[model samples]
Target: MFLYMLIYLAYHGSRWIPRKQRLKFQIVNAVVITLVLVPQFYVIGRSKSSRYCKQPLLNNLSASIAFSFIASGFSVIFTLIEPIPQSLWASYHLFGLLSCGEGLCTTILTLTAKDCVKTTPELYYMSLFQTVASILSTGFFMVRGGLWLTKLNPGTDLSGNNESPAVPH
Candidate 1:
């Protein structure tokens, strides 16, 4: 991961940015990645260590609140960075990096939460549903954001025209 970041920055992000602004871009992006990763690392570690000792997060009110805050922070950080990348390359790379991180988060949840799912079948179904729904929504919003970045309206039909279809309702 560290090596990938070094190569990614040197070859991709910094190469396209102005020489004078390259350092700032790299630093800010590195910091952003770090900020996003720390909590994920914590969650992965906690999942491993808490297999037997910890209470179910869904069963505990305060713990659920704390988890909610962490989730919100994760979302808010992504939201804040959504418009920062000006170029298509940068935007796609940022999305790739974030999606890579999200892959780990999703993988860890699937692996570590199996025990809980065994005890509660609904948890499995709910997680599956949420995972699919969130992925779809995230992709959709990113596409819309990209359209906005390119000075296009997402509501318009992009099939070689600006006309939007009328809603049946």
Candidate 2:
């Protein structure tokens, strides 16, 4: 999930670079984004035949896959549509919210496990930490999205507009 978030950030942040260089970077971004999902698919496939497959773990994995798919779809669409900055910002926040759902499922799974014999201290700590991080990230993305929306009009074409709304000096 963190990897996906970083990729999303890089894909969006590429807009800050000069246009001539942006195309090459975006191509690379798309490749990397696709590569990142390979391991996840492998994990899901391996888990399918495993005797220890549990509901919470499966839920977490499925949510993560859904988030990845949605992010990938949006990234491709953004590249084709060249949406405004406000849309990009909103997409990132939406991704963050989806990530929170994955984190919550993981936390619940970790907490409600009926069998402690298979669980370890490290697993518990990791889930707890991730839940906290996801909550924090959700808040951060929401605030950042709101700020961007306020600063940039959603209807404006940022691709061609050179002048942004005036800021008080």
Candidate 3:
């Protein structure tokens, strides 16, 4: 639990780094994400670890889903905290990146740990489900925010065709 919190902090804290230092933050973000993913995969992959865990497989998967939702919430919180106007864009991008990273980490770990899952179709569906859910949730919030902005400033272009608003302090 402590390790997970540290990884979360590393990823979340990176947002506070100045723009000039963003590259460093990105690197740190990547490393920390990798660290968190390792344990996540270990818990999910079929093995003694999964079997010995207190909860059943369904419960474990549910917990994983909940974790992603919480991560999404954090992404939103971090975006709101950002001083820049384009923070939503950054947040969504980061959320997507984190989703993909976690999915890949789990998939690779599953395959490497065992050959029990034989069907590629099952994996495909699972991946699709995760991808769709992550995108829908993130996009929903982003669009909602945009709609609010448009409602607030009628003169500003509200159409989806309009270019993204410039970042202002």
The lDDT of each candidate is 0.45, 0.59, 0.48
TM-score, prediction 1:
0.32
- Between prediction 2 and prediction 3, the one with superior TM-score is 2
For candidate 2, write residues 1-169 as lDDT tens digits: 4533554576567777765667776787688667756655665565232335343554465566677677776665555445548877786667766666676677677667545225433333444455565666556666777778756765455454645577799
lDDT of 1 at 51: 42
Indicate which candidate wins on TM-score. 2
Model 2 misplacement above 4 A: 1-4, 47-49, 85-95, 111-169
**How would you encode candidate 3's per-residue C-alpha lDDT over 1-169 as one tens digit per residue?**
2222333454457656675666666565556546545545544563443333222332435455556555545533443454545765465556556555554444444434333233333333343444454455456546766778787855456464545677799
Error of 1 at 141 (Å): 6.1
In terms of lDDT, the best-performing candidate is 2
Tell me which of candidates 2 and 3 scores higher on lDDT: 2
lDDT: the better of candidates 1 and 2: 2
